[model samples]
Target: MNKENLFDTEDILSEGGVRDLFEEVEVGEGEKIVKQGDAGTDLFIVDSGQCVVIDDKGAGRIIDSLDRGDVFGEMAFLGGELRSATVRSNTPCKLLKLSREPFVRFLRKQAVPGTKFLIFLERFMVERLRKADSLRVLISGDQDLSGKRGLQQLRADIRARNTKPLLSADDPILSEICHWIYARNDQVLFREGERTTDLFIIRKGEVVVVDEGAGGFLLGTFGANDAVGEKCFLDGKPRSDTAKVRGNAEILMFTRDTLVELLERDSSMAIGLSLGLGSLLARRLSMANRTLRLLTYEELREKAEVSRLLSEMRKSLRIKTLH
Candidate 1:
């Protein structure tokens, strides 16, 4: 693969803010840049060579071949997760390595508000994970093997899973919830500052959480099986960010009045929802903090300057910590 063909050099260099964060590294053929299970602290962009991704099955597959302008190793950096695959140079190559801190800073500096910024970061992280999963399936030559048997097995696995439910499928109160909505690709689910109207659950497909980008950077994308709009519903506050469909999606929704009626009747459902909301909020906050910490100083300055509220918030946090 031609490096130049893989990435738009001028566009990525301009928008990715990678020029300063990247350092040139030369690798011999078969040299490994990332090892599975290692703690990931940096992401790489191919500058002049192709790389192969190796899975635990000892299968070496070319998921993506890069010459330049392509990025990898993003999932671990965004999610604080361990490297899920090993990336090795396929030939003598020149690569650009961007440390996590600087990349996070770069994302932060993008003209997005802090809260929405965090939501975007979460979506971005999830998108990378999905990409990696897709690559795994492709490399295993299973891309065309979507068999009914496999799907049935997957369904069985899901049924057998012991994970706690965010909301019970059979909850009677669900029937009374109004304001139900279905979203199609690129449809706006809601935007920052929209009145709190309903709580949503991912019945199917994916919804991306994005921030209102003032003029800076795209925060990220999120997908199916995720619930959003709970914060606004719970707090009676305006929406903090934007939610949009990643693809065709179905959302189970409960209007504010329905929630109130539920609370007035089956208080336990409200309590469970509150607990679930807290868990989701905590996870979002942690991801945001990780992203903020990973950002470079320049990125921080850019974000701080974009919004006065963000600037003051950053200043207050810094001061509070100092005292």
Candidate 2:
């Protein structure tokens, strides 16, 4: 779950020929491995020693430390975006770099290993997403829960006509999971902390996830072909948010046990489905990180305003004393 000690490098990288897939880079202490705001096209694994992920705003703050077998620069494989934070060598280090293009080719060629690596990556990002979500709440004292448009855009990207969504297509394999059911308006699909492993894929209309942990703040709004409650389904963890039908909606509801049966029955279908879910998870994590950064700056602004108010209070008291 935590980034460190995530992969058994030899087992994961070597078994599937993942070891040959990455190009190794050696760095001197204090060397920059990734620069913030630069286009990220590769994911990195700490092969030896350590690296520090740092915030690039003013005096850099260390976000996290990467020890052997840890992953960083993963935003690259999740799909291209500017690097959110900078990673630099904390000591002389060795890193394995995995570029997007070659990794895709590797996945196409190998089946099970690709699925295995993707499952590993999905779990890793989920942990990161939860950590970032908690940090945002800590800084703001409440979750902002105002990124409806942004979250929708992420789902749209996955469902673009030309794009294959991270969710499985409605096929024999998918039908085994669940069939479409017309859910009514005001339907409570699931609640936070409820024991449910159902993965919902909206076919028509809207479903919104409310963070009951944040007093029912709107966490995410998802629509057609968008997967929801996937984090719980993937990790077999309890639901962290409540999902409700915004309008009379049609959706496909699948259970984790059925999915596991599919995995056992057909390796290729299972891998493809899992990979798609992994991609969707990556998109969600990306949005979560960006939102956390904005929250950080927002907290700074509030602190400055508080200081100014204190200064004005002091001046007003001094003037009243003189009068």
lDDT of each: 0.51, 0.66
Query: How much is 275 displaced in model 2, in angstroms?
Result: 3.5
Best by lDDT: 2
Question: What's the lDDT for candidate 2?
Answer: 0.66
> Cα RMSD (Å) between model 2 and the true structure?
11.7
Q: Which residues of candidate 2, in runs, are more than 4 Å off?
A: 1-15, 136-164, 168-172, 257-272, 296-323
Tens digit of per-residue lDDT, candidate 1, span 122-155 = 3333333223222222222322333323434433
Residue 186 shift from truth in candidate 1, angstroms: 2.3
Residue 244 lDDT, candidate 1, scale 0-100: 78
Per-model tally of clashing residue pairs: 11, 0
Clash pairs for candidate 2: none
